[model samples]
Target: MKQMQIYAFDMNCVSHINHGMWTHPRDTSLQYTDLDYWVDFARTAERGKLDGIFLADVVGVYDVYKGSAAPVIETGAQIPVNDPLMPISAMAYATRHLGFGVTANTTYEAPYLLARRMSTLDHLTKGRIGWNIVTGYLDSAARAMGFEKLPEHDARYDAAEEYLEILYKLWEGSWDDDAVLADRARAIFADASKVRAVRHNGTYYKMEGIHLAQPSPQRTPLLFQAGSSARGQDFAARHAECVFIATPNPQAARPIVGALRCKAEAFGRGANALRVLGLITIVVGRSEKEARDKLEDYRRHASVEASLAHYSASTGVDFSKYSLDEPIEQRSTNANQSALAAITKEASKPVTLRGIIDQMVLGSRMRPIVGSAEQVADRLAEWVSDAGVDGFNLARTVAPESLRDFVDLVVPVLQERRLFKADYAEGPLRQKLFGGRGRLPSSHPAAAFRT
Candidate 1:
């Protein structure tokens, strides 16, 4: 029996992946600004023994459609977003077991600054932190950062490679494990000789300093990346411990999962070095009929315009300019390459404006699973077996109610089938997830930086 991991995929805003279902009466996403909401959510996820709550974020608005942010703003799509890092400490305090995977873009934030923040959180959470690495694709973000245009797709990753190497030097190399000695007589907090400055001069970044904070449980937070393009997968293969893929079905996921593992093996990380998680949304209930009814009810609040606006930003193609049956031009842009390829070159069927709208009827490209707990479990087990993924990242539909239902209703069935854990394992996030040491293993490239 293969065990599966699960994460509650969400954002620090009213609308995330599902587009426009926040208007549902039971949805509590509107209260995202409230500390209580996040704290409570962490508690709930912990109670259900969820592995983690993966928080997605963006630095810019979805302004691609009609070249304006009006539609997204009007629908309250994802514009009113807050910082994903803000609620993490509060959430960690509220729960002992739930891990946090927060998205932070490498393109916009400095490696030196990010390493300290992640180390601080790992210390606070007792090593319950993971970083979802992303490079910005939004022109709006570039504009905000004083750049006239975004860097080319592959060039961003090139810079990221250097960014990561710098982080590795700071996080893994700067401090020796035995440097800290709380010798009462000597009164030495840290051995000055054992700690050294990490200096680097590269094409993309330069830094000369010792790490500000001592090493946390995981000297480096668990690395995660969602890049399905050839270049993106190569980057993920070289760095990510966990890779996220959003495919329509298990079949579509199979080859990508294989590629990720194969690439990891080529890098000498072994085939099991990476855990792949497929993006999914489930609306499970006590019975099949009840689940179907709930899906219909939730579908009533779907915001097609908001979904299109979000998709436009994702693919860097304005759906507003195309007619219903007009073919979408799959032009290369600084945006997400996989997002564009998924609907154009790699699509299972001919994709057009009409097809895109049809897919978004349920909010995003993914089709939600509506079934009894047993049926849902069966589907998930099949997903693991056929897709070769280790788990699924559950996207939210109606906020707390949707997650609450899955935890209360579907978890037990999966547990019974031995597909999900009955309780969390002991240790820091890395130890719990992959077992063994809390720090990067010697085989990992980051370990090369270790003294």
Candidate 2:
């Protein structure tokens, strides 16, 4: 079997995917403000031979439940989040081969400015940066940005399509590969004739100038998308190099993954071009009993209120209004459609507030693997084969401890079974992932814009 790629999933905040876990005595998430915390985390991931660290982000507070932010603020449910891009350079400096995928929403940001920011990071990191594109899903975020209300769900995706086009023009089309001629004696940094301006007047954005920065290591950063809705899937099929998915079971994911791959192929991309990675949380230890005990201990710290706040914000449904035994009504909402779909279509049965809270006991709905090293490795292999997924994005249940356990226990077993790499590869993030140096594949749309 081919070695499975693993991304240590995290966010620059006290609370990320697993909300309210900051109260866990063993969790060091509260130290997110310290630069050394992230740098140390990056180095640890590199030592474990993990593929990268994927940092998730959100531009707004979780204010949907009861139309207020107090619940989230009180629980620290992803509130007081720091900027993900700020500490990435420091982390890059600490590790040689760990890739960084930082999420930035396109809805509120200007395309030109975001393009410059990503390019600058690409240059500084020597091409270890990737961007996870997201459209804002919170009405509070839109209102905070001075918009009257959030755009419709499908409309947001439409705007994103145009947003990406403008970025591609700036990143891939503005400068030629040979445009930069750094001959000190000649004193010519670039050939003006080779560099051209890109002009586009679209429904969502308008740009009329050359790209601001010189081409970085990868003209276009590796594209990642986490959209599972119909429109969202269409956007991913057109542009995403890697698609992030969260499913409750492999049986549930099979149809969705198949549909996505088929859609990408229909859009003229090879089936393998879009790598799919499912979210996972593992609790592995030296023995099965030890793993179970660890999980039980972690459960005691999980905050039910914090989980409800997060769920309410993500689905645009206030759980406070419904009884614990009340079945959550399936309806279309302006929030994250993928999240809503997961609860309704992917779950075994209709979800109630009680069921949601029960699942939240460990913070997230991702299935946890609790066993010895060999047992954990066997289950991971089963997931890879049965789900047809390329890899797993391991979510942190407790700060460095969750990662430490996996590295110390499961990694060795995976290595012994020849299912995980034992050392770093020799180049930029793209080169390490795809076995080539610099930029995207020729078949990718971004390549067409290259000068």
Candidate 3:
């Protein structure tokens, strides 16, 4: 049996994927600003032997729901968000093996500057880093950056391709494997000849510079892509090592996973070139009834309106305009096409306003797996077998408590069943997740730029 990888989905805000759960009395996600909160989170995840804590981020508010940001602000749905990159060093200092997958939008920042920042983080975390590549999904983010609207969906992906190519040159081509000499007697710090400046005159960007930082343990951090659109999957096929997907259930997940693997194979990469992780939420307790009771408790506080607000931002469609019974019509938006597809094309039923509310348990549309430890383990194994996924990115119902329960109760059962690892594999994140290799494989596009 293949051991499954697990990552905890989180964000640096009071509310993340689970929109209204921050209002839960016990939820401490608002402590997101404090370094101790992240340090504690890293420690707990490491204790559970989780593969990584993937932090999702958004630069704009969910104003699309009601033509204003008020609903989002009033409900505290993913607003007042902090920078995901800032907490990494502190969290890295606190844990040994837990990887940090920080979200950074390639749509806004320049490739050269972003490359330096990631390399610096790679050095700080000792290569325990992965980048969740996203092109900004919200129009507000574009306006904030002085653009009237975001670049067209496919157009953004085009820019990202060029952006990634430049990054590859800087990270893998510019610095030779042994550019740093540190010769004491000869008084030479580096072999200048071994380091070369990269020049890119691409359609979207122009650059001529050597990477500011020296090569880290992993020249390129592990690449994690969450694009679920058709073009998005093509990008993932060529670039991503791990792919994050949002499917509503196992029935929906199987075909999507198959399609992504097929696309990867078509791109000349192996069928298993990408590791697919589906998004899910779990609610566990000592007894099945206890878990159900806890589910009811969490559901009581979940705000359906906040859930709609979140969905509105991701798909660029406001549920507010439609009647409760009205059927949703999916349209092309500047936002995430994959997000919309998850509800419409991927789901077994048509998405409606009232139907959308019914899906919100603990403030998100992802249906929760509620059971005892043994039952939860069985369900997870079944998901791996039936859905053809490597693992899950588990969303939170409460704060550390949800994660704490999983680590304490669910992890032990998984380890006992040989579905989860007791001890972490030694090496950088890429090695631990894929194999004992700290860099992208030869099949990956980034490797083509290697010196």
Candidate 4:
């Protein structure tokens, strides 16, 4: 029996992965800027024994809908978004075992700055930090960064490869584990000889400096990536300890999971090197009727147009151009190719605009599991046994209430079956998730840079 893990999916905005659920009268996402709301949310997830809280972020607004940002703005698709990294320290302070996996794109920011920012969070959280590596999928983000258009998709991944190499050198090679002496008698703060500058003149980046910060509890934060495309999977196989897979069903997930593991083995990282977490949304209740009714209630707040607007931005195809019944064709996109694949060849059949709308029952295309606690637990176990997923990345439907329900209703059922952790294991996020080891395994590519 494999143990299943869970992470709460969210963002620092009103609407995250779910399109327009912010309209739900009970949703507290409107208070995204409020610290009290975040602290409480973090505390709730910790109480639920969730593995972590993974924050989704985007640097630019969703403007692909009708070639205007109006619908996204009106529905608050993902606009009014704040930096995802800002709330981690506060959230970490409010909880003990919960981890934070923050999304940051490699295309927009300098690696030096990102490496340090992540290190600072790792220090603050005492090593309960993971980085969700992404390459920007929106052209609007490119414009915000002063580019005429987004870089070619594969080219972006190419740059990311170099970026990670530099990060490894800085985080793993620049400082020795015993470099921090903090000895007052000899007035020595750190051993100078144990630290050295990292020099890299790669095609995409050039830097020659010692790491800005000393090594935190985990010299490198646990690496996470969610790219289901061929090029993306190759990068993930080499770098990510955990991979996020978004599919409509367990049948769609098994091959992706198996391939990722096989690719990791090909890279000499061993077959179990990568842990695949499927994207799932749960709407649980004390009774089956209660869950069904709750799902209908949430459906009433769903906005198909808002979902289309978000989909347009994600796949870089304007839904406004296609008729409701028109079939969508596969085209080359610099945006999220995997998202497009999910509805096209990757799906059981071709999906059209109407099909897309029909799928947005919970404000998005992700299939939701609605049932009593026992039923939800059984389905989760089935996913683990059948889909070959190590865990789940739970999308948020309604704010605190959705999370609160899972904690109060579903967690006990999973624990009772011994499929979920009742108590958190003691250590940094990496150790808790992968075992008692507090650092990256020697088989990981980043370990090659270690001193």
Residue-level lDDT for 363 in candidate 4: 81
Q: List the residue pairs that clash in candidate 4.
A: none
Question: Lowest summed lDDT over 10 consecutive residues: which window, candidate 1?
Answer: 357-366
User: Across residues 21-97, which tens digit of lDDT does each residue of candidate 3 receive?
Assistant: 77779989888889999999999999999999999899878899989899889988888889999999999999999
- How far off is residue 182 in model 4, in Å? 1.4
> How many pairs of residues collide in each model?
0, 0, 0, 0
Q: What lDDT tens digits, residue by residue, belong to model 2 across residues 64-91? A: 7878999889988788889999999999
Model 1 root mean square deviation, Cα atoms: 1.0
For candidate 2, give the lDDT.
0.87
Query: What is the lDDT for 253 in model 1?
Result: 94
TM-scores of all candidate predictions against the true structure: 0.98, 0.97, 0.98, 0.98
Query: Between candidates 1 and 2, which one is better according to lDDT?
Result: 1
- After TM-score superposition, the amount by which residue 449's alpha carbon in candidate 1 deviates from its true location, in angstroms, is 0.3
Which ranking of candidates, highest lDDT first?
Answer: 4, 1, 3, 2
- Candidate 2 residue 155 Cα shift, in angstroms, is 1.0
How would you encode candidate 4's per-residue C-alpha lDDT over 1-451 as one tens digit per residue?
8889899999999998777788889998999999999999999999999999999899988888899999988888888899999999999999998999999999998999888999999999999999999998888899999999999999999999999999999999999999999999999999999999999998999999999999999989999999999999999999999999998889888999999999999999998888899999999999999999999999888877788899998888888998989988888778899888777776677788988888888888887999999999999999999989999999999998999999999999889989999899999999998885689999898989998
Per-residue lDDT of model 1, residues 291-319, tens digit only: 99999999999988999999899999998
